[model samples]
Structures are given as C-alpha cells and as structure tokens.
Target: MSHWLPASPCTPPGCAVHAGPARRPVPAAALLLAGCALTLAGVLCAPLALSLTGGARRERLVRCWAHAVLRVFGVGVRITGPPAVRGGAAGGRAGTPGVLVVANHVSWLDIPLVAAVCPGRMLAKSDIRRWPVLGPLAALGGTLFVERERLRSLPATVRSLASALHGGARVVVFPEGSTWCGRGPGGRFRPAAFQAAIDAGAAVQPLRIRYLGGPPDHRAPAGAAAFVGDDPLAASLWRVVRAAGLTAEIRVLAPIPAGAVPGRRELARLAQSTVASDSANLPAASVHH
Candidate 1:
C-alpha cells in the first residue's frame, strides 16, 4: 500500500496515487452564462419548492432541479452500482431497511450531485443553513444540518441522525469532514455518524465520487476536479461551469451490515477501506488492517 501512496488518476488498476490540486482556467463567457442560468434556476425553483405541500412532491422537484443544474453546469453523472440494498448481505429470508450512506467529500458540487442521485435528505454542516438563498431551499428539501464545531451537540446530533435513518430516510454523510485537492481519499472517516447506522440497525453503504473531464490546464498531475483549500464557492462554481462535459463518477461499493455490534471504529475503517479500493486509490489486497 505504501508503494502506491500517490496514485495517479487510476492510470492503472489498484493505484493509490495523489494527483494533487487542480489548476483550471475560468472562461469568462461560459462562467457568466452558466452561473446566471444556475442562479435563475435556483430562484425559480426555491419558491416553487416552498409552495409545494408534500415531502414527496418537494423531493421530486429537487431531483428535477438537480438534473437541470447539472445540465446548466455541464456536468454529467454516471452511477456504477445497485442502489443500497436492505436485508442480509446474501440472499436470505430477512428484510432490508433504510441505509446510512457514506462517501468521501471532494467538492461543493458533491451536494447537488449526491442529492440528485440519492434522492434523500443529506447531512450538511451547520454553516450551510445560513447561506443567503440556498439555505432555506436546502432545509425545505429535507437537509439535516449538524453543528460539527460544537463539541457538546454531538450526541444529540447522532441521535437525531439515527432517528432519521430509523424512520426510513436514506441519509447521506461525508465523514471525511472536509474536501481535499485530490481524487484520492482524503482524511479518515469520523466514527460518530457511523454510530447512527449502528443505532438504527441499518446497513452502511460506502460510495466514492471521482471527477472526469476538465479543461487542458486543469488536467495536471492527474485529471482531478477538486474544490479544496481556500477556493471560494463562486470560484469553484466558475471552474465547474467553465469545464463543459465534466462528469462526476459516483461509485457505490458493497454495503456493510451494522449487525454483530461491531464498534463504530471498525465500521468507519471498513467503509473508508472499501471506498479507497473501489475508487481505485488503494489495492484490493490492502485491507485497512
């Protein structure tokens, strides 16, 4: 595993190479047009979403908005595995329930793309709830905001998240806590939210998102489309809109059951290992032992 510490954009199988931060040029016209379209689309949909009465209707509208924004942003999504399944890992007489979906975080775009594909409420940092116009829309669309900075609120947050999962909401969380400047895995997964799955007796779905297609300048040590460091949202969004045909490759790994009462640390390690392997950032033989 150490031999492949710096994987190179999956150039060969079983790589764990670091492609490094991306440098892309922002096309002025494309950025302006795409930005305006996305803003207008959000403005048009927010009130309509607010006007809608039912959760199902609102969720559908959000999904539609996700698709439209992808078009406006020139991003395409390709999902690679079966949706998270309930029930025993093998074919059996047991039944399946809602899942606690976990993934590695890379960009702000991760939000809408994940929402579009998963079609469920997502866990966002508390700061997002105060964003200008997007905050209310996200809350209305069923986003569950967690205050990670406060050490005291953790238990309640886990309980709240567990309750949501138990109630059959497919809750998505990025346990890496923050974004990085590589297509490879970032930091380790925090175990707190994994405990929610354990509490809810739900299966843990491990997924990974890899970016594809960027302008020539952006394709450096590897073709990484990361929104990391001090990049402002507008700058990151500008990079996205400027790159036509950019794709977010969402890969779903095999689900890990929360039964047997394995500790949350084990679950987090397993999920992170699975994501690294499936994402081609680590060799399959490199079990997180």
Candidate 2:
C-alpha cells in the first residue's frame, strides 16, 4: 500500500525478473506521453479499417499497438497455462466460441500487460469511455463500459459481454469491480460478469497480477503493486513511470469449462477461490525479490 518506488535495479541486468533500471521521473513521464501519442496515432486507423477488414485484422492492429505501448513504458508480461486449443495462444474455449479472461484488478498497467500477450476486448469502467482521446480509441475497439453506480444497468452490461463472447472475441473483465493493493487475496469477485461467460458458453480464465517489489538483489518492498483508494491517475502513472525497476508477474490459472460450473453465483465463487488460493500461496514477495 505504500507508494515508495525502488531506488535501484537488481544486478545481472538481463534477468526478466529484474525491473531493468531506476526510473528518472522527468524522462519516464515524457516517454509515457510519447508512447500514448504514438499508440493513438497508430490505432486511429482502426475505425476506418474496422469497416473494411473482415477478419482478425482490426484486433491485430490494436494488438500490435498495445505491444508497442508496453515496450515503450518498460512493462513486461508473461502468460502461463493451457492454450485456448483453437482460437490462439491465449484463448481457451470450453465448447464455446470465445474466452472470458477474468483477472484481479490492480493498476491500469494490467491492460497493456494482458494485451502484450494477445488482443482482447476489454470491459472498462464507464468513466473510461469519457476520456478525452483514449475513450474514442477504446470505443473503436468495442470496449464495453460498466456504470458501477447504476445497479439497474448491470443486466444490460452482462448481456453485452455475453454477446461479445458469443461473437468469438476474447473479453477481459476485472471482476473485483475496483483496484486494491493486492497484498492480500483481491477483493471479492463480483458474480455479475460470470453470468456473461455462462450465457455465452465461454471458458473462464482466471488471471493474477502480482506487483514486483524490492530491488532485484535486495529486499522486496513492504507493499505489493496496487493503485487503490484515492490516488489520482496522474500520480499513479508518475509513480510507475518513475519506478524503472518495478515489474509485475501475471499468472494464468487453469481455465474452467462452460458447463463444468453451474450457475453464475457458483462460478463466481469457484473463480474467486482459485485466485484467492493462488495469491495466498504465493511465496512472500520478499523471498522472490
């Protein structure tokens, strides 16, 4: 929960576990903005192309751009688990057309991390849809917005997610409903999104995001990577940008088949338990650092 950024990078610089360098705030911020500009300019073509490209071309377009953004920002991603078997490297289908990637919400970086693996439609907070520039890009990519404050809108949002899955697009949802420090098992997995997977007969893939703490060679930091509470986006962004040596690990657990789980509530419980157990069993952050 502490927002202190590490001051040094671990030795043996090439190690993926090592967060390469100590970030210089001014340079990192400029770089972050540059990356955003590049991404926006590149993806701006998606809207026009979406209408003409009849295949996975549009997805690939946004995907390639996402990879570029993550690389420019110094975040690395690793995905582990069984393959989707049919769709692609990150897809897992249980006699269904698409995959419902359910991950624990941490910082906004989770988006590029996952996309660095493969492209997928994301379910974002309603406010994201109103952002100045990024909002339009997301709309072109078919992002679904959840009005967390409007209870009556839940059913419609779930239905939209189901439709996306049924249409063969990997749909990523952060069911925690908000961000947390991630030191403990994440907040409860709200069951609303589970219904989307169930209705679409899609396999549910549980993902865990662990923020790397400590200098690669020194002690792990006291708190885990999380962007929670009242931290402004600008502040969180600057913190990450300045922490050059900071890194996060993504673990993809076994996927749950469509029919294997009954009822939305039950599915939510199983998924939550699996993620919670994994987070609990993770070796203390200090040991790994």
Candidate 3:
C-alpha cells in the first residue's frame, strides 16, 4: 500500500485547495463486486423501462440510472458552465428545435457523465453496440452507432443525426475519432459528423470533459474501456472511485451557427480549439501515487 500526505498546508499562487491522499479501507474485491452488481442491474432495467415508456419519462429513468451508478461508485462530477437544454419547456426551454453537442473524447464514463447532465442521444462507435451488457443498454437509450470503417455509410449516419436534431432530440458527438491518454491533444477531430448540424441548421454546442484523477499517473486513466479491461466492471470502477475524486469541467462554449463555417473541417477545428483552450486552464489533479 502507498501512503500519501495532505497537500502541503502552505498555499501557493493560482493553487486550489489540495485534496488529502485517500486510503482505501474497503477490500478492493468487495467494492468491485458491489459496483458490478449495481451496474448490471441498472443496465438490465434501463431497456425494459425504455420499451414501456415514451418521451421524457424514459429519459428520466436513464438519467436516474446514471446518477445511481455514480453514487454507488462514490464518484463526484462538477460542471463549470451552463446546464444542458433539452427539447421544449421542460428542459429549461433553451429552444424547442434542440441543439447538437460536440465534445472531446476522454473516458467511457463520458456517456453517463453527459447523459446525467444533458439527457441527449449519443453517437457511439459501432463496436459499443456489440458489447455484452452496455451495448443493449445504450441502444435502448437511443444512441446512434457509426461504422468508422465504412465511409459510404457516413452520409446515411449524418442524415439520421440531422433528422434527430430536427425532431427536437439533442445529439452528442465525439469527433476525436479515438481516445488517448498523454498530455496535450490526442486524436484529430473528424469533420464528417459536423455536417449533420449544418444540414439541420441547428446550433452546434461544444463541450469539454476533463478527468481530475484516477490511475497509472492520476491522469484520465487511458480510455474507460482500457481501464476496465479484463477486470470485472465493478472492480475497475472501484479502482477509479477509490483512487481520487473525479472533477469534470463541462463548458458549454458559445453556440456556433450551423453552416457558419463553409465545411465540416472548419466546424471541427473551431470546436476542437475551443475545448482545448478551456481544458488547459483547469487546476491539475494529482496522478502520482
């Protein structure tokens, strides 16, 4: 086991209160089991609720599940800017037509993190649709799956996304194409999906998700999938939950008018720059054990 001291009592310029080192009292095995059980139960229940209910009720159930998972894992999430707006007056009436959100790729938790806050449909990789438990759960949540290898299918995917936007359903896309762990930027943003926002004439909302602590060196532990690897889902999650409290700064950058940029590339660039700039300013969370 490792011993960590509270951040030095002396305050420094531009420094936030440092969190004391957390000790894992509960047995890792036990915590893992409990977390896995809760996650599986939640995943199983979500699909049934979606099938029986329509409209906001179904979404609320999913959001509840997301919150439940976070609570069970003892994770904390903090948002920095405005809350997300859903369709119509119920979602704070940002507008009825709905908005398209573009966010950076980080961990798999990004799904539930955004879902818990915004309550929007997600655009996920085709592989997720085939996962054991999560696949079905996400499908029930109305997540849009895209095949990255099939360039020909891109148009159809964009059209579906556009239609969803016009129908008053909020949609989220991670344009980084893949996930990465090192400091600085990871993958380049893929512009194809931005076409959906332009075609639908919807405002493009940019969001940035940054993890404060959790693995190897405390950086956003690789991507969520890798972090969860061969270990039981519950165990992997507990490792993160016990490692450190996670702080996510979700900034809703000013809405960019659809088609304001002549092409998807321009839209992607603008969104990427906005997210990168905002992430750079957040306080660094300790990764060293």
Per-candidate RMSD, Å: 7.7, 7.4, 9.4
| Poorly placed runs, candidate 3 (over 4 Å) | 1-26, 51-54, 87-96, 214-242, 282-289
State which candidate, 1 or 2, has the greater lDDT. 2
TM-score of each: 0.75, 0.80, 0.75
Give the best candidate by TM-score: 2
* Least well predicted 10-residue stretch by lDDT in candidate 1: 3-12
Best by lDDT: 2
Q: Give the TM-score of candidate 1.
A: 0.75
Q: Write the residue-wise lDDT of candidate 2 on 1-289 in tens digits.
A: 1111111221111111223345666788887797677667755777677788644565566667776776676655446665432233233343346888888876777777666555678898788787666678777777888777667787898899888888777888888777655555556678888899889877788877776656666533223234665555565565666666566667778778887778988999998887887777655532223
Best-to-worst order by lDDT is 2, 1, 3
Please give, for residues 241-269, the per-residue lDDT of candidate 3 as tens digits.
Answer: 55444554455666676667888789888
Candidate 2 has what TM-score?
A: 0.80
Which pairs clash in model 2? 84-91, 84-92, 214-221
Give candidate 1's error at residue 216 in angstroms: 12
Clashing pairs in 3: 217-287, 218-287
Q: Which stretches of candidate 2 lie over 4 Å from their true place?
A: 1-22, 48-61, 84-96, 217-225, 283-289
